[model samples]
Target: MLALASFISKHHPTLPITLISTADAASTPPSVTYRRLPDLAPPQPPIKNPVESFFETHRLHKPNLRAALVEISEKSRIAALVLDIFCNAAFHVSAALGIPTDFYVSNGSPGAAVFLNFPTMDETLDVDIGDMNDYLHFPGFPAIHSTPSKTVVFLCFGRRGLHSAEQLKETAVALERSGHRFLWSVRNPPGKGGDVPNLEEILPEGFLERTKEKGFVVRSWAPQSEVLSHEAVAGFVTHCGRSSVMEAVSSGVAMIAWPIDAKQKMNKVFLVEEMKAALPLDTGEGGLVTADELERRVRELMDATTGRAIRHRVAEMKASAAAAVGENGSSVLALHKFINDCCGRADG
Candidate 1:
């Protein structure tokens, strides 16, 4: 958003901008001045996945936002209102005020297409998502395969967070001897009892030392788009989070699905059974996978020949994704049409 805001300011300097966010969002990047609005204080007990939780929490600043919008519209004639797809409630306010609005799912277009196709997916495949063999022939343009070892693995949780401290220590240990290159996000290491712990103290002893050259541990919130686009990322080990899925597909990276909680498990099943774009790791219900399981799975994805083939197919999908946002890209056309209808013209 900062990037987009900066681009708009630089390329269209005359255009007035009013940035809005929760009070908590007020911080650096002081260049883009904003009108802080009333945003719900996040829940006292942090939800495991805040985004999902936020949607569940119906409390909104729309009334306050409406007043602000009305004020702004009165002065400058409000044009287009671009909103995140998950914020469905925004439509009500926009509709009430007769304001034009367009939804933006920053993830790739493929994810959006898949989300729309959910209702049409075969109901017979609704059972618990089985192993790679059970899903190797799943539906969709990109096919799946049963491979042995893999080269690169992309890791991120659907909820965007670290696993338990014990889980991380175990994973680090397993990766040390596996000899496979990994691109994992330990963005924030698990803290002790309640708060975030000092990362150095939490990491398994000598874990970083051993994997120093072969692995990359992102200690900060990652620029996922940039990382996925990097050539070294061959296959993504993901929780099938919509955003991650979109980013990976946009970059044409194969997947190894290891979904944890809500929506994710469902998304994984779809990708493996209906999308045929990924391999789902098996973990019996509520039985947390051991380090050995993670190691074996990672090795299979990185070194297997079939896994290499999956990577190739993913590359093709990546091209398709790029085209969707390119010159005549679906997203590009959509934006153009939106601008024409709301802002008056593309040139404007």
Candidate 2:
């Protein structure tokens, strides 16, 4: 959102941009005005489950968001209301005020976005998503294949307690066994008594020393976009989160899909089955992905034949994505139409 606001300010200096959210905007750009909303929901306890916490916060933010929209609209004329897909509550406010509205899917893939709409579209297809052999083909996209590249970045979970301690331990062991140069961003799990532990305490003893030359384990948040853009990063092991997928695609990095949540599972299907831009990792019997499997997949993704083919395919997607956002591109034209519709004229 900040990036978009910065771009608009550069191209259209007279236009005003306002950001409304519960997050602190202490480091926001000068061109953007940040409006903090009051918390209407009760204070939440320390989050133990990241997925459940996300939904809980979303539900709590709805009433406060509606109130903020009302206040903002009354204070100034809102030409158009742009909202994230998760914040569907604001749609009601937009409709009530008769304001134009558009949803922003944080994921960069328009194909993935369209695939998500399939459930709401015609229901006659009758394809089982659980079947690994069942292939999905999107219009104007190549057939999906299970292939990826050499150097990989495993970030299936964010800097929070998304995975269990056992899962984290297994992941550390897998990275150590893979023998591939990797950058793993790991966060401490929610403490038993609200006290976060050091990396050494959280991970296996001597794990860092053993892999220090071959791997980089980041304890806090990582600059994901910057890291993906690096030339050495050829493939991504991701949870298929929207923003992470967007960063990977925009950077032209292929993926090893290891979806952990429902929405991420959908995204994995679109990328791996519908677009062939990624390889799917199979958890062994009873869905337990052993270190041996992880090591083998890493080697396959970094091998000469399979990895090279996936890189070629991803390069094509990168070019197409770039073209779509370029001058006179489809995305550029759509933006023009949206702006014209909302503001009625460039001057507004």
Best by lDDT: 2
Candidate 1 lDDT over residue span 150-220, tens digit each: 34566766335557767777677667767878876764444545334445666787777778788877654
Model 2, range 70-178, lDDT digits (tens) per residue? 7777888888777776676677767877889977776667656455746753453323332112223444444342233335555546544255566667888988887
What is the number of backbone collisions in each predicted candidate, taken in the order shown? 10, 3
Whole-model lDDT, model 1: 0.68
Give the Å shift of residue 272 in candidate 2: 0.6
Candidate 2 stretches with Cα past 4 Å from truth are 1-156, 159-161, 190-197, 284-287, 344-348
Score candidate 1 by TM-score against the native.
Answer: 0.49
Weakest lDDT window of 10 consecutive positions for candidate 1: 126-135
TM-score of every model versus the real structure: 0.49, 0.53
How many clashes show up in model 1?
10
| Candidate 2 lDDT | 0.71
